[model samples]
Every structure is written in structure tokens, then in C-alpha cells.
Target: MVKYVEGSFNEDYIQTLGVNFMDKKVQIKSTNITFLIWDLGGEKEFINMLPLVSNDAVAILFMFDLTRKSTLNSIKDWYRQVRGFNKSAIPFLVGTKYDEFVELDFQDQEEITQQALRFGKAMKLPVIFCSTSHSINVQKIFKVILAKAFGVKLVLDEIVNVGEPILVYK
Candidate 1:
């Protein structure tokens, strides 16, 4: 997750280095809040550091792969771990790889969405479907997180003026 945000997308998924965790400072655009982002590795060895890293997070983003059901199932454990550290941490359930999920059949897509929706409702957390490769809903996810964390409303360009003209010809 940190790698993706740091603009390194072409790297391999496997962890070759010995680094278990990383921290980066990220400034949310149009706002003064700067998040000290922590990317914790999921390896069993790094599990012990969860309490140290997750305890201070303002918002926790639990990301799962849309194409991988196991990843979705693992969210329960992740949520429990994060909550164990800091119950006040606002958590957001995110489903990644929307671009790949689009190639799947309707039944598969529906099943995943329904399952995620049920889980989100049960957890009382907002759910988002996004794709880093396609840049789908990536910014919106942060905007929502910022809003939830700090009660700041982002100015969206998509808001339409109802009384505005459709076209202007000179």
C-alpha cells in the first residue's frame, strides 16, 4: 500500500527485503491534515508490531482483493487486530482490483459485492471498491477517509448546478 502511494507500482508483490514496516508522511490535498501513514507487513513475524503501529492511526484502511475471496475473509482478523490496538480508529473496508473484477461473470461480481456489503454493514464501516491500476475511486477513498477522520468536506467538481445552461454557443 505504501509502495503504491509512493508512486512505485511496477514492483513485484513478494517481499524480498527484511523490512517489516514503513512509515510515510502524506498530505491530504485541499486540507492541512497530514497523515503519518504506516504500512505494516502481513507476515506472521510482523504481527507483533500491530499494537505499536496501529494504535495511533486516525483511520485504518482494510484493503482486500476483489478477485480473491480469501483476502476478503481475512478482513475479520485484520479488523479485530486493528480494533484491539485502538477501538477509536475509524476503519474503512476497501475492495481493490475493480478493473480486474469487471472481467468476471455477473454472478461472481454480484456474490462478491453482496458479501462485502453484508460484512461492511455488520462492521458498521463504509465500503469502497477501487483499482489502483486504473485509478478508480482512489482519490474518493482518501476524501472519504479525511471527511470521516476530521469532519472536513471535500469540494467536489462533480456537483452540478441544476439551473445552469447545458451549452453555450458563441
Candidate 2:
């Protein structure tokens, strides 16, 4: 993971490029399915530093607490910002706290879901609501992203076997 902190412009976050070794090594006869994952800054002040959104990104994962309607509502502006940056219409949407929503008011829940649906329709992207704390549908999120980005069909044969090894080409 490479951390980029362009402090002068109030933007700071980490970006990582790697392969999911848990799955087979792509079995590629020629090239690797390389990827770039940008874990962007969530701070309001840092939002401005995002580079122009474009198709270079495979997906954008917007995560927010399900118990906080305010936070959920805030995603719209962020979505616009991201959409503007991502001019190519790559897949993107909100990821809510699935389990945490049990504690939120019913009205808030409906509103959030409505907002999510509205945003999804407007952006032509699907909204994923899942919980990481309880490990609910966590793995599926990556699967959806992978399917959308690569247009490849994948099923869970088994958990991917990830190891630490650096490949060298002569």
C-alpha cells in the first residue's frame, strides 16, 4: 500500500496495487490482472484533493454507518464529487453498516434506503449494504466489484490463498 499525502492541498490517503492471491494466480497465459485500489480520505476537508474522476478506476466503495442518517445523507455530495471525478461512469455506490442499522429508527432506515436507491438509479450503479463487524456479506462485496470491473464470472471454489512473495521477471 502506498500512502500519498498531498498536504499542501489537504488531501491524504493510501493507494494500493496488487492481486488477490487468495484466488488462483489468474492462470494468465501472458499477463497478470493487475489492479489499483484507492482508499480515499473520508474527511470533508480532504475531499477537494481528489484528482479528476475517470474510468481509470475499476470501482469506488462508499462506506458509511447505517445508524447515522446524517452520514448516509452526506454521501450524495461525495457521490457527485466522485462522479465528477469519474467521468467514465465506472461502478460506484454506498456501503451501509448492515447490522448497525438494527439500532436506527425505522424512518431513518427508509430514508437512507430511498436515498441509496435514488443515487443508484441516477448513477446506474448498485448500492451494497453490508456489515464488516459481523462479517456479513463482506466477501460478496469484492466479488461484485470484481465481476463488474472485469466482466468475468467467478464462484467461490475456496478462500483465496494469499502469500507474501515478490515475483521477478528475467
Candidate 3:
């Protein structure tokens, strides 16, 4: 997402070790909004940084790796911890690595999709599947966040079919 907002992509992978910050200004529905992004590292050791990240946040992205189902299981714990600090923070269930996810077998894809949908429904969050490398549904994440935050209906259509990037927010 940092790359997407920055309008560039890097081939090399540099994992977030602790926390990183990036700011971007965008025009959505003719409204210019500035977004201050905090990229907290996703590691048990970095869980201590939750208070700093979750405090006063408008939205919380509970993201998991689509290729790794175990990551999805961790979402429950993360969401619970974040909710402790900010119950009103809008939550989003995000599945990353769609480029690799679509390459998996149909059964695997269906299983993951069903599980993600169930989890999203349970949390009452908008579910979105995206590939940062491919820029698929990357910008839509923030756009949906803004629309929901301001109670505005998005004009974009959602794609929910299997074997495709899923964007379910109704």
C-alpha cells in the first residue's frame, strides 16, 4: 500500500521491522484528503507497539497472508487486542498476496475464501483481497475506508467471484 500510494513499486522485498510512516494526499470524490499511514511490523515481538498504532486510529486493518492460512488464524487475537484500545475503530479484513493466491488449487482457494468471508462477517468488517505486487484492490482498501468513515456510498462495483480478487462491502 505504501508503494501504491507512492505511485511506484520496488522489486525487492523489505519487511517492516518495527514501524514505518508514510503520508499521501489523494482526491476522492473531489475531496482532497491526507492519509497518515503507520506500517507496524507484523511479529509477536512487535505486538507491544499496538497501543501506539491502535490509539486514535480511524481504521484498523486486520490483514493476513492469503497464501498462509495460519496468518488468518492470528487475526482473531490481533483484532481482540486492538479492539481493547479502540472499540469504535472501523475494522477491515484484508487478504494479501492475491497474485499467489489465485495460483492455488480451486479447493484451496474456496476454503480460504469461505474462511475469510466467515471471519469478516463475524467481525462485521469489509472483506477485501488484494495483491500489493500487482496493485489489485490496493487503492480500493483506502477508498473504501474513507467512504465508510464518512458514511458515503462508494460508486465502485465489488468483485466477489472465486479465483478473483474479492471486495465485499455492502
Best candidate, TM-score-wise?
A: 3
List the lowest-lDDT window of 10 residues for candidate 1: 161-170
Error of 2 at 104 (Å): 2.2
Estimated TM-score for each candidate: 0.77, 0.63, 0.95
Candidate 1 to truth, TM: 0.77
lDDT of each: 0.68, 0.52, 0.89
Tens-place lDDT per residue, model 1, 1-170, is 54345645443566423234444455656545555666666555767778877888888878788888888998998888789889998888888877888788778777777787778778988777777776667767777777777776656443112121111100
Score candidate 3 by lDDT: 0.89
**lDDT minimum window of 10 residues, candidate 2:** 161-170
Which lDDT tens digits does candidate 2 get at residues 7-105? 121124232222211222222336576445555556676665555323366566666666676766777778777777775545655454566675666
User: Of the candidates shown, which would achieve the greatest lDDT relative to the real structure?
Assistant: 3
| Backbone steric clashes in candidate 3, count | 0
Q: Give candidate 3 misplaced runs (Cα > 4 Å).
A: none
